[model samples]
Target: MSTDAERLGWAEQAAEALTEAGYRRGGVRSAIVALLDEQSCALSAVEIGEALAERGRRASRASVYRVMEELERIGLLARVEVGQGIVRYEPLREGPGHHHHLVCERCGRLEPFTDDGVERAIQRLSERLPLEVSEHEIVIRGACRSCAD
Candidate 1:
């Protein structure tokens, strides 16, 4: 339920953070904003670049990838890989219980899932597991409804 303006502000803030982190933000700013405006579920860098190109915006592939990395560093997006080499990028929520995702391997569809139980279990595991867990991602991958149908 975020307005486009709000998303732009978020992107700008993210860009500022990137600058602080020493990553320069350049022409790719529009590409990042366009991705937010489209609100595509989860996109790879190439996919983002193609989306901008469809709208007559010439977002260079390198710029799109750099923008994505900067956005990830600023906590504006989450990077997820579904047992594949391609990393998917999703906008981050400003509140707790960041929704999990279910990914369709064949169709590349992403569906959001949320449950307090998941958070509790993650916390419990962090306490016991040897891994240092700050943030975690959970993705269930399989054929989706339509694909199965």
Candidate 2:
């Protein structure tokens, strides 16, 4: 999750990039970008469409897919594959908004968690290994509290 300011900042940055790339800054793409920017976790295209419908904004499935692809191509979105052929997309960012997912296998809930210990361990492992770690994603899976209960 990101702060309100950070979310807005991301939206602004994405909008600017789209404009600079000869893309217009409105319609379904604008709406999707704004909605995704405010999200705490990655969302599937179905989820995005449902959300937009709930907000009285209509976007077709094809349009949503198109915009998502465009944003990803421009480096504004990242794809997260949470197994079971399910894929989601989140804002691609760095710094304070960075975190990993806690996936609930039972309920399919995705939660974000940040741990300095895990980060430090990764750093140490990278140093010990021969490979340079350019990026990483850690997804912890289990039943969430409610599902467990």
Quick one: best TM-score, which candidate? 2
Weakest 10 consecutive residues, lDDT, candidate 2? Answer: 78-87
Report the C-alpha lDDT of model 1 over 1-149, residue by residue, as the tens digit.
55656666656766666678776556667457556645736777877888788878887788787777767766778877854677888876544325788988987777878778988898898999988866777888999999889
TM-score of each: 0.71, 0.81
Candidate 2: residue 44 lDDT (0-100): 94
- True lDDT of residue 53, candidate 1: 85
Candidate 1, residue 26: lDDT = 62
Q: What TM-score would you give candidate 1 relative to the actual structure? A: 0.71
Q: What tens-digit string does per-residue lDDT give for candidate 2 at 49-91?
A: 9999999999999999999999989888878776677779999
Clash totals for all models, in order? 0, 0
Q: Indicate which candidate wins on lDDT.
A: 2
Among all windows of ten consecutive residues in candidate 1, which has the lowest summed lDDT? 31-40
